[model samples]
Target: MILTGSRLEVMHFVGEKVEGYMKEFLKPVETYWQPADLLPDPTQENFLEEVKLLRESARELSYDYMAVLIGDTITEEALPTYESWLMEVEGVNQADYDQGWSKWVRAWTAEENRHGDLLNKFLYLSGRVNMRAMEQSTQYLISDGFDIGTGRDPYRNFVYTSFQELATNISHRRTATLAKQAGCPQLSKICGVIASDEMRHAKAYSAFIREVFAVDPSEMMLAFEDMMRKKIVMPAHFLRETGTKIGETFSHFSDAAQRLGVYTTIDYIEIMESLLNEWQIETVTDLNDAGQRARDYLVALPARLRRIADRTRIPTLEYPFSWIA
Candidate 1:
């Protein structure tokens, strides 16, 4: 859908502050942690011993845990799709390389690049993952892309990202806790740092939406409500394994995640509620009649989702994921 004049105007308005947001939300390259910092170094003479211990710890991880980890890795590895999608947003055109929004996207991608790298290398050293099959799924996800209902509107896209980044933070944080409990301190630390990055990114996206709300509360409110109405889709929903049709692997992956409590339907509701409270949806004033209705729907949505969440059951049965060795 074509953006309204007001939406386009607000997008440019928000884009102008991209530099300030980048500095506030992102870290300097020199000071940031690299994947190599957390992994066993090949040049070190003790690398072999470290790998042996890593593999031993990885063996102790449950099947469900491994499956969820692999799925998370695949989604993170599909950074190309995400960057391309964001670059195509209303005012964040990548072709305009000089724009601050484009600069922010590139810098954000730089930080995110290490997540998949760190996790994949850890998995490889752990020797508990089917590397080829996992690689295939990642490739498939990047190729298939996804339709997240955001279109090119910056308002809807930011709202989606705000929810998504927070969701990922929760997932990774939970995985970190689980990893530590399962005797993999190193892996736990890896997830911990990545989760931290996700939270910072979440804050940045949330800030963008808040800025838009300040200028265009009515449109912003409507966009957020529209997104929640459609539901935010995880990019992993497009995941596929070898010889399987698109999205077949997602059901099994999601089940494994649910079974493991890595990411759950309840978590979805909670994230939505968090966004609602953080954005002060109920307090947004001066909205048009339609915008007011959208705000009402958004405010009440969490409780509605909670009722559904309470009634829904996660399957006790586990589906075999090809990504696990």
Candidate 2:
């Protein structure tokens, strides 16, 4: 459990190795992907046939993108925290500890590769962004990179993915919107379907955190607060770095998500409250002063949500979180 100094060194090395493996994994797959514009127009109802064609053509690229996403996030965001977690785990001396964490890392990576390949193959075979500026955007974003949190470890890891899954869902949904707006019915349908898959992934992580809360209430709350306070950005920047407007970019996506009936304000609150109540974090038997403060904050979260709802006009407009005053 407790990682001595020497064990920490091993973790750092493992982290480095994992990062290298991620880079290696990304190489062959990304090559086939073209920028967004070159894809076929969905305006033609005949485009459905094209989409069907892509279902076969784009599968590998879609899989690879998902792989890269998982690897990049883990390497850039989660690995350092795990390195810290070598210290957090309860019993094993890290130096003597077998490479158990790496196994978790690999499994996680395997699950991630699926999304990218699915999306990329679809985009390329469809000939979506073959244009110049769009192609440049892709390069710029990936080079700039995006991240979720700092040395927060598995806790931060959970938080990052919780938000990420939703964020990615929104992106997929918006891509659908763009396709629809561009008269591409086929692309819209494909994106809508893919977005649903993303929503499921996000929900899985959210549920996992809820389970985590049941076991370690205080730690969960601390992690929750940390997640909220820290910046949560879109991972697309990993492939397409635009710049300061990212905050605006996320806002636009959030607005789209609300309009689409994907995730709503209540969804966010429900996820948070479910974890809090399941853990009975607010009612912990041993309440240190800091923990007590956190509990107070947790108790007030609903009222905070109420104010946000009021400001956003979610209730007034009969729309969810739509009334940001």
Candidate 3:
């Protein structure tokens, strides 16, 4: 089915299948894991003992790890900004209860809400985070907001989410591995579950783009190219501390992540390569001249990025984060 190059129409076409996407990607809330499930229960008889154990394990975590975790938590806490932005996308009408796009956004938000909650609670119990400082940063991030360069375009929005979700998945997965290596199994489990959610969400967003490519190949290809050309800015790009300017904290946080190998330039290149493969950019048909050029640019982006990444060096200096006491 050829679309009129209307992104709204393409969104509606794909939104119609959101119910199936939700079923496949998002789990029923009743059965899904909650923050309390992974955390020490205040009502439990052994709560104090569990807390002690948690703190003990947390002590083994490196300073860089703590900084990265705090940054990740702050980013997740800015969900309100993300949801508000997505709800305003051209095809999503929050007033329409039956709008599939709106439903997907709400459901996705609900699932994502657990990530920050779980991480915040864990950090608090671990006695490693400066709760007040972290809370302030979270508030600043939400209030500061962000411009991810997607504007209100659904095609660009989905492409951004697809890339962002995969990036989060890599960071979380690596954090989990590092957690286990630090002898913090609880934190590892927490990061592992969150990573799983990210991967699932990534698949859903990628599927949306896949369906779009089917009906609006040229437009979808162009959108993909445009986002890559502008570069995908992470939500945490707006993160800040109490005395710091916007994005100041994020620079240090990013360096910590890079140093720890939790998330790096290599991961970014790999994500681009994965998306190119996932959408079969090289083989996509029905593209106009512009779309063909976009596809050519995208197909070559990973290699180009990797050569630059090879020369990039992670900062060896560690900035003293207010979030870490």
Best model per TM-score: 3
lDDT of each: 0.90, 0.48, 0.94
Native RMSD of candidate 2 (Å): 10.7
**Model 2, which residues run further than 4 Å from truth?**
1-98, 127-135, 166-217, 230-251, 263-266, 277-284, 313-325
TM-score of each: 0.97, 0.52, 0.99
lDDT (10s digit) by residue, model 1, range 1-325: 2234666677787788989999899999898899999989999999999999999888889989999999999999999999999898887878888889899999999899999999999999898888999999998899899999999889899998999999999999999999999999999999999999999999999999888888888888989988988999997898899999999989888888898888999999989888888998889877889999999898888888888888988988888788888
TM-score of predicted structure 1: 0.97
lDDT of 2 by residue, 1-325 (tens): 2222442343343343443443433223354232234345567777778666655443323322222222222222322333344344432234533444443344344344444444444444544334343334444444444455535355566666776667656656755665566555655665676567557556655655554444454555666676665545445433322343433333443444455444466656665565556455566644446657767777777668767866663321222111111
The candidate 1 region of ten consecutive residues with least summed lDDT is 1-10
Over the full model, what C-alpha lDDT does candidate 2 score relative to the true structure? 0.48
Best by lDDT: 3
Error of 1 at 161 (Å): 0.4
